[model samples]
Target: MEEIDKTFREAVADGRIHGAVLIAKDLTGKVDFSRSYGVRSLREEDPEKRPPMVADTPMRVASCSKFLTSIMVLKCVEMGLANLNGGLEKLLPEVAGLKVLTGFDDAGNPIEREPKSPVLLNSGLCYTLTFPLLQQYRKWQGLEIEQGYDNLDQNFKYPLLFDPGTKWAYGPSLDWCSRVIKRASGLSAEEFLQEHIVEPLGIDSDNMTFELQKHPNMQARRGDMTFRGGHTFTAESSSPGTGVLQYRDEEYWHEDIEPHGGQGIYTSPESYAKVLWSILSNDGKLLKPETRELLFKRALTLEAEKSFDEYCEQFKAFVPGVPVPAEIKHSHSLGGMLTLEDCDGDRWRQEGNLSWSGLPNIMWNIDKRAGMCTIWAFHMKPWGDPICIELGTKFEKAAFMMLKQ
Candidate 1:
């Protein structure tokens, strides 16, 4: 444990990361190790003037939000409010009639068409819908460039890339799932989480809130974003794909629309670790044993798994700064990525371990077999930056080694 702590502190000292919070725990809910390093934000003019990072420091967990969203949807399933195999047409009527984006025409306009089959609620959670939604939201807000998408109706009107359940593409499908939860439960996503997950778990409300602006305490503790360029950090926000410089304006922190289920939640490492611990222990207090089992089990079919692998391969080139390891064999579960087999040399996670990462380098994993769950969070941009990858890998290796002792 001491050695793992040393490695993390050294990484911050060496300027590899702005700051990070890590939490590792055993099956009994005892914390095996936990630590925070560096500043909460490098946006300050003087590095020495920055606030110190702490366990309770709030951060946008990015796609890590998917895990919570998935659980809530499953909770609705448990309450008999939803069907896993049901098609979206009945649950989310707006999305049921939507088309998919096929390709671009000679004029560089999107070629859209209808899907051959309906999108199941189960498969919808794993697909990508965020980018198109964002584009549409900007248009609805009256932004001129890239305008025209109005609501869920227009945002999801693109043609399907492939039949749903046949393949997987990462998108805003979970956000739509959140919408379904809202409709079925008669509560907002934030309200449902507060009444169910947050309150029941005894987690601090400020620690895991959907509304950062409403929670002033969390806002004060929010970490600033950084990129890989220098030892010194800047407060500027950059668009995910395009290198366009943008401010972390009102839209960045607060959305007038319903909370995004896929990527909008903000939380701390300690707060989220509690949720993971519950899964590792398989306590029936929240989800039944059978439902918990589904989270770590392989949910993708053989054909879909192959498609996911190819999709990941194409995405690797777009990310700069780090090389994504190709040795890891993975399958998708309802909760996150399930490790199918051990990599040739990489043993960061045991086989059957469920893991996933957020867009800003935040990552977490639950290794039920190993009696451990872990999270690594840093407010950094360009998700696949090599520095973040290397730091995260080092942290995992150190954690497993500590467990062995």
Candidate 2:
């Protein structure tokens, strides 16, 4: 792993990234390695004064939260708290009633129509409410919503991009699923996750939480949020694509409503590793064998897989850093992206491996065939930052090579 360390250090020295935490473990327990590089916050110029980024430094993992949330939802399914194939009519009435947003009219009104199919429990995608009608509705209602389950009824007022089960589009479907978990278990999403997932895995609350503001220890250890020059959410920099890492004064983690099941998580690579490890090792402490199989198996229909393939091809333009081979086919698992073929010509992940990423250039993999799982976290943006890609590719290849040895 010397090359991996050297590449990461070089990137930090060159201002390509702020900091990162990488952890790779295998079921055989032969190759266990982890490393933390660079300072957590660049606010302090003096190296001695800056807090060092560690494996447990709390990070707003963004969409990587979905992987954990998906597992929790499945756990609910195993415990009879959720039904994977059930319709959303009872579990989520608002989502169930959502209409299709076909287009607009002469007066600029959103065109709507009832969906031909019912929205099932599995019709989830990472979506944001940017539609004109939905925005107007929220503004008219004076909703001061942040990212949480309380905002779901208001947020999903927008029309579905396509009928559920017809095609795939990334939206707030998982966020709604979180609501289902809550209603079925008769507990808040956070409470259920803590009792079932967190406590069983032996992770400390300080290391993983939905409310970063409440945990001062995690708040203090939180890393700075950095973004590419043209990519900061607040404003576009005059000089974009300069590869400059600018600090953003924004908080993606939230404390309001039930914890977002899709993307509201504050956690560390080490803490999350336990969750991934539990799945990778097939340990019943987290899920049943049948339920765990759901994470690695493909769950998409032929039509959905075709749509998912097109989306992946388009996603490549955004994800320039990953070394996924072009020939590898992708299908959605119950948890995340599952490969139908060996990745990187068998040099990295084998067939049936599951993988996904977050907005801040975080990537994770769970390879049951290889008995290994890995997470590489860099809290910086423009989702597919090249520096992150380079480091992640190196780190993933190195981990796979270690397993081969």
Alpha-carbon TM-score of each model against the true structure: 0.84, 0.90
Model 2 residue 328 distance off true place after TM-score fit, in angstroms: 2.7
> Taking the tens digit of each residue's C-alpha lDDT, what string does model 1 give over 1-405?
676678778877877667888888876444477889988876676877989998888888878888999999989988899888777667787777756665556765566677777777756322322245435433443454221232343334334556777886775677677788888899988988887778878888898867777888888887777655432112222422223211132245554345777777888888898899888888765688988787987888898888667666665532111222544566788898776775323345777878877867788888876778888887776566556667777777677666655
Off by over 4 Å in 2: 124-150, 230-241, 253-258, 317-327
Candidate 2, 267-342: lDDT as tens digits? 8889988998988888898889998888877788889888777765765544322456645777888788878888
How many steric clashes does model 2 contain?
Answer: 5
TM-score of 1: 0.84
Best by TM-score: 2
Stretch of 10 with least lDDT, candidate 1? 231-240
